[model samples]
Target: MKTYNKLLLLFIFLLFCEGLQAQSKPSWIWYPGDFEVWLGNKMQSRRTERGTFLPPFWKFDSHYVLIDFHKDFDLQEAEEAELYVEGQYNVKIDGKAIFGYPNRLSIPAGKHKVSLKVFSQDKVPAIFVKGKKVVSDSTWLVTYEDKEWIDQSGKASDQSGTTWLKAAQWNFDNAATPPSAYALPTVPQSPVKTEKLGKSLLVDFGRETFGFIRLHGLKGRGEVAIYYGESPEEALSIDHGETLDRLDVQFDQKKDTLTTLTKAFRYVNVQLAPGMTVDSVSMLYEYAPVKDRGSFHCSDEEINKIYDVAKYTFHLNTREFFIDGIKRDRWIWSGDAYQSFLMNYYLLYDSPTVTRTLLALRGKDPVTSHTNTIMDYTFYWFMGIQDYYLYTGDRSFVEQFYPRMKTLMDYCLSRTNKNGMLEGLAGDWVFIDWAEGLSKQGELSFEQLLFARSLETMATSAALINHQEDAVTYGEMAKKLKSAIMAKYWNKEKQALVHSSIDGKQTDNVTRYSNMFGIFFGYFNADQQQGVKKNVLLNDKVQKITTPYMRFYELEALCALGEQSYVLKEMKAYWGGMLKEGATSFWEEYDPSKKGAEHLSMYGRPFGKSLCHAWGASPLYLLGKYYLGIKPLSPAYETWEVVPELGGLKWMEGKVPTPAGEIELYCSTKEIRVKSPVGKGTLRFKSKSLPKVKGGGGLLNKGNGNYEITIIKGKDCVVKYN
Candidate 1:
């Protein structure tokens, strides 16, 4: 009995010791610092940022394992190499199967050793070749040569034990380091008092230090100089600019304070000569030393909160509009470009990453000095600026970029023909299978309509700033171009516009994009509009426009036409498809059938997946403008138009910060309410049917017979019925 008891106790102790060893063993903890997560055992992470992992190989919900190989051996010299883990995972050499585990091994939380062995092709004991054996070198060679790899598993771990491999670093810290400097003070506490003194606009900092000065809408040519002192005579000039360059000057830290000035005249003053007019100005200065210069730290919780609110607002608007839910992979290129235009004035505002990315994508290669293809970059720039202006209401941005904008616009105008039409290469002149089948023969589709719409926007922008001559020129050009388009492309017999001109002759009979352009460019006549509605919107031939490419443009056209029901139905179908396909973020395209087809593609290539956050960011802005009906006239935010068309939505309310102030607009089943810092405008007794707006006051009535209200005080009459 004593012997049996002693044996039992020994067995129990052994089992307990094994369990503890298993628990304490260092299993591979995924390094959050790694940017790219390898999809397969052979894959590796590429780019790292903020400890978020991203994989080089683009795939949806791909599982990755961070394996500590424990040994690194030269691949060239080894007779045979095999990777081994405790679990029953398949092993491959150069993607070729060499060995398979007899029993499936499930990895638990603890340290585990994995091994890799390499062998020469001739089956002889290979010698170590430094550069040749390196995996990175092999990968580069394979990529450059466009060679393929065969999976080799079932190979022995050590055919010839040449040398022991060294262990790799597995545990890495990924905590974010805080900024070394203090946060800059938000402007100065001292009240900035403004007084119009003669031909100069004098600003008194009043015992406060100033760091940056921002001015908006200083028209024509003039020089603005900053000065210090109680009287203009005693003021000393700090910075001076020739020509009207809307003020956006950042002062040096040494001269930021009033007391730091050696002379009494060291004051900040801006002079707008007799011919110039100033819109608005903001003086930013620091009260004390700042903690950080460039880095602005926000917690993940805070960032996520902002993202959630923006996402919710965007989803809500998208749901209301019923835009197609076809999860497009790289479709954000178009959407981001458009949003860039809408928010152009806000490029210097919040969200530096977003703006930087947009700008980076705009011009030609940042690395090389080469001009980009005009339409591609120009369209993107146009959209970026539009979005920037709409969101921030920063007129100074407009002034700074206006010259660049004009330069791009002039380039476009120069490309126009005698017939008042613009022509350019389509699809970068590269023929793809899908695109080829659509047009049959490659031709520039009436896609120039998007360009025309941009022109109209440019014209409207010019008109808003009281550039009457420029407005008239753009409007006339638009009118003539519309007429020429009708004469050149419209087919009265077929009741649809030709898709594009082949060899300068209209040949393709398809009506997909041509009609879309017609709606987009505001070129459709009364009879043609009804025909378009019947043939395109209600047509059953195309099997529901479930592709993101056409869906974006189609939705925009629908909004322009005020066709709520069709827009809502399409939006539901499209968005529903994406949500069902397990999308955490918006996709490039949607496959409704759930076939094994690739979900994300770039121009129909496997490597073309771009998880564009900017593209996904656009739906929110569009929904706000189209569904909620909050439109801004200029960056100043002083003038706005409230025209709500809720479509099939239950209720919607949102706020967009403009230059004039924050514009809050909301709509319910009963009424539509619009509130701004200037005043309030209400449209009462709303129903399923569109509201009838009567009154000339700052609003213009659309062809769909809906009222559009604009609030411009003093200079323009309260109401002018159009």
Candidate 2:
């Protein structure tokens, strides 16, 4: 009787724990990479120009139509697991088929193999199995094509061609919320003010935002039109507005209707038909749910405001993936996302979003064209992978996606000209920036620099995955290309890399693109770095980078070269120029020379410029990396450093995120405080006299009044220096 009572109590406790876990964590699993592809398609299709559907011109791919998932488990006792599937599926336990799609399966106490084959054409095939010990998760293996066949005896099978990868799963802990049903969260928002003009209502949401507009108590028999704009002037201009929506409603009684699509706008002009009435207007503000794990705040308020606005701009651009802008495109552009990936490391530190964006950009095999059909953008994709690994230190992602990387690199290799170098081809777009009359005619120095960087990334990634042979090959390729770039483009008279090589001869024109990148990419030697900095980056004679897209790198190059004070002033003058113009969010391009409504114009259209571009938010990176001066010297910050710069600030402080945790700091003229959640950090700073330390051991002098102290994890280090 006592044994029976004890057994009942133990069972109840175990059951309670299982219930707690199931409610807290999702148990769904799918073929790795399929969900991201399907989700990317859904998100990318959301763009619209005025009222017309706008889809990507690139060759977008789709998810696999079918998949097989399986796992083996050893049980100490009989158990029951509840199964939920996203599509039609068949279950087999230990090579025996179950009858009629059983929702619950009872497994005897022993080792057994459980498999499920699912099919779906419109969505990714997914499944969830919840039990105490047999929960479905990444531990399960999956494959899109099993490539197995049965012989006449019905027992013989050949699966030599089959390859199983760990099932992919992200935050889909709920069986009800499968990957297909995923959407950005939304909240209801009321407009700040509305003005009525002749049956037309003009509404202002007070700032740039993206959402579905809701029309309340709608009773109409004709058309209701909405014009969306980033500015009030844009909303009032009916025909020239970038985005609009039209709805036809016929209802005897009041009916509330929400717009089917989201639009990026601050102002809306609603034109209603005669007798059509809406009591009020509201919006459902749609946004991605990413935490601000990283933070920045300092002595300068204007700089702080720029940082805050930059964060908001980046947050707005960071939707399903790192989109180019909220106002237009709303698709993953590799160049834009590369800056976003860096900003994410310093702000959100959301690794899944990083991986998801990378996967979506890569898509499935058969590299039909360069990513987004642009040569530089293709190279950016490979560089993004390198940064991802550097920041996340996730080897599994590289291992799983290495083949795709190889194929993409092979596509680049296959397109090389007779000189074993790539140039502008018929289909390839050599888009370095949105600058006008930028030559893409001959071999551009910028393209070769990006190519060399991509090759170096491939070499590093190959070594990470133990593909040593490929690593050596890519390493040699990178070395050769670097030599060719210097030989073909470097002009000592210009003191910079020439813009292009026309028919194997270097052009005299020099641009900031390659020179700025070389500084940060470490492609230039000590002398070359200084020469380029003077002749190109800081030289007023050079063609200035007008767009924030290129400015992200240009400013980054300056920051990497310890020009934080100059970069800070430039960031203030450029990004601060936008703030002065009442920009609630950063623009795709900002030319301080342009005045008034001219800021709204681009590509020959009155409102052609995107008001919230991802690259425009680069100060989030600049401040954290340059001003804050904390970065990972090794992958995932296993080894890191802090060399804080005052950068003309009286005091400054911020926290930067890492894979293991956050690195926090506070700095001033006389004192500095530092703490990290993960290992072996060297804190280097300049001091006038011998510094004092607490929570840290002895400080070693590195000459010229510079000192170093070892920072241990979970302990705060304080230094008092004169």
Candidate 3:
């Protein structure tokens, strides 16, 4: 039955691809990771602080200035192909160079090799080739250094050193829009209301947003100052803010102009100079082109509202690459992006975006400082890739990037001390959370836990790629590390994994970081699980997690431990706390103790906190995976399960994306509905009585009032568990 299903799905997919191919044309392609790297630079370089150009302080890498792209094609008949190149490029056919910069070329019948050598310093070297049958796509191979040496006799040297990768391409099908001309889609948006406060027009856009401010009908020769804010207070404050723009307007006619950089703000304070006048302000709302593939709607209004705002927050942060936030430090942070990747699995399920973001974060590997200069963040990068593979079942992605993974893992392994533990060396940021007075000293238990998980990821990836010895090595290393962590960090009195060990001795400090992770990572046994939950997770004395970054794992651990009902209240109190504060989007951190504009402060500055941070969207994952309870048991959803938990909701329904299709589920007190387009699934639930399918068979009883039923693809199942 599975074989037949696979074959049928393949047939349907082929038909769909045929339809798409008929409409679409060839797109530009480049060296596999170069495009993403270049694009990351472009996006990150656009970040401005107080209208001054601000770039990343870390070592930012660049794309290859030179690249060679080539593809061999066999045509039964002669054909003409049009070519578009981004930089100073030379086209070649059959290894012989063609004339200067030809837009069109003729290919003779039979097998032939078409190639282009391009040099671009400012942008990625890319090309778009289109024809009736021959076109540019992933089948083409690209290399950064094409060291092909030919002697006088026209004999070439061994091309061993020249590494060729499958070319990467996105939705750049048009001839006019090459890869270098890529930009996010934008839509014009007007302010909800505007008030003239003396010289400045205080414009309210109603909610948190990211866009380029446009000045309409401008005829001035003075500067226009645009102050942005997530709240009205931030925009109103002129000198004290995170992002603001001052534009010099020299327009003579009644024309319109837009601010050069896109900023995050709902409120814009347009302060014009004395001579600058006669215009209203609007914005071009810039955003990614991702479509919503998964959804969640629950019985609770606040939960629904929280879910909506989380979704919007994630959408705002999902640009060229998943960024930390939009307003400040609009750069990719691995830890922030890891959460975004998980959220994306439930919301967008955009596999390309996942791969693109991963590539960008990985960058060009020379094993620089830990990802984002934070130790835990580097581990998150590996875990992110592993999760991507599990969610999408795209082994080729793992297989392609395993070398980089190995190199990164090697860098990590080399840093371990004599006791097989990691302590923050000079220049390495421990960065467990944003909590105050958190210890960066000593061999941290949280880092060890993440390192063990990262090793496990390496083991899994290595095994997938059939590297048996390396897999065993990584597996053993992970096993040993877990043991080491347990020996060093576990405290019987504390009844939890202590926060860190000070010089080989466990500290009395009991934090939720390692303990919460231990529960979900399956590192803790049953008794230990109960101990940690009681002593640390629920204990009032334990330091609380204020950042949404740590709250994500905290909540996930609770959900995994079957405490969703309790977690529901926590979610309401935490996320719902932000919603009640008139938040249009989720925030970087939310402390109930902080009142009014106090919520806007962080990092020693007002508005230093990002209002729509990517990590703030954990509910998307929690609701879709935990509440809807649709998750893959095998890679790519070949086998999956639905273990829906209402979590205090009377009824909750949602769609979860799988590799092949979606799992649609509706769960309530009396009835349950499930329909899936891919994979075989087991629907598990509990009731006081026996349950029967609407069509026929009774559910299988697993004792203790538990019931389950097998769910096959393309079958709409309705169960009455009365």
TM-score of 3: 0.95
Which regions of candidate 2 fall more than 4 Å away from where they truly are? 1-26, 150-158
TM-score of each: 0.46, 0.95, 0.95
Residues 506-624, model 2: lDDT tens digits = 88899999999999999999999999888899999888889999998998888877788898899889999999999999999999989999999999999999998899999999899
Single out the weakest 10-residue window by summed lDDT for candidate 2.
Answer: 18-27
The residue-by-residue lDDT of candidate 1 on 1-722, one tens digit each, is 99999999999998787555333322122211111111111112212211134333222122212221222332213322111232223333333343454222222223322222222221111111112122211111100011222337553433342322222112211112111111324443333577776766676654323244555554555444444432233342222211112333343221221222111111345665445566655555432221111111112232223334325322311210111121121111334344433322221123332343333333321112111333433554565555565555544445433544566677667666555555553423221112435553433445456566666656766765667887788778766666666776777765677667766687746456668657755688778877776676556663354445446666777777778656755655565455444334444455566543355444644323322223333344445556666565544444456666667666666665444445555565555455566433333122334444333244444545445554433222222121
lDDT of 3 by residue, 152-246 (tens): 88864436677888988888888899988888889999999999999989999999999898888988788878889989899999888788888
**Cα-based lDDT for every prediction:** 0.41, 0.90, 0.88
Residue 20 shift from truth in candidate 2, angstroms = 13
Worst 10 residues of 1 by lDDT: 136-145
Candidate number achieving the greatest lDDT relative to the actual structure: 2
Clashing pairs for model 2 are 26-173
Of candidates 2 and 1, the better by TM-score: 2
Task: Give the candidates in order of lDDT, highest first.
Answer: 2, 3, 1
Off by over 4 Å in 1: 1-335, 340-377, 383-395, 406-436, 440-445, 454-478, 542-546, 596-613, 616-618, 633-636, 671-673, 678-722
The 10-residue segment with the lowest total lDDT in model 3: 690-699
Prediction 2 global C-alpha lDDT: 0.90
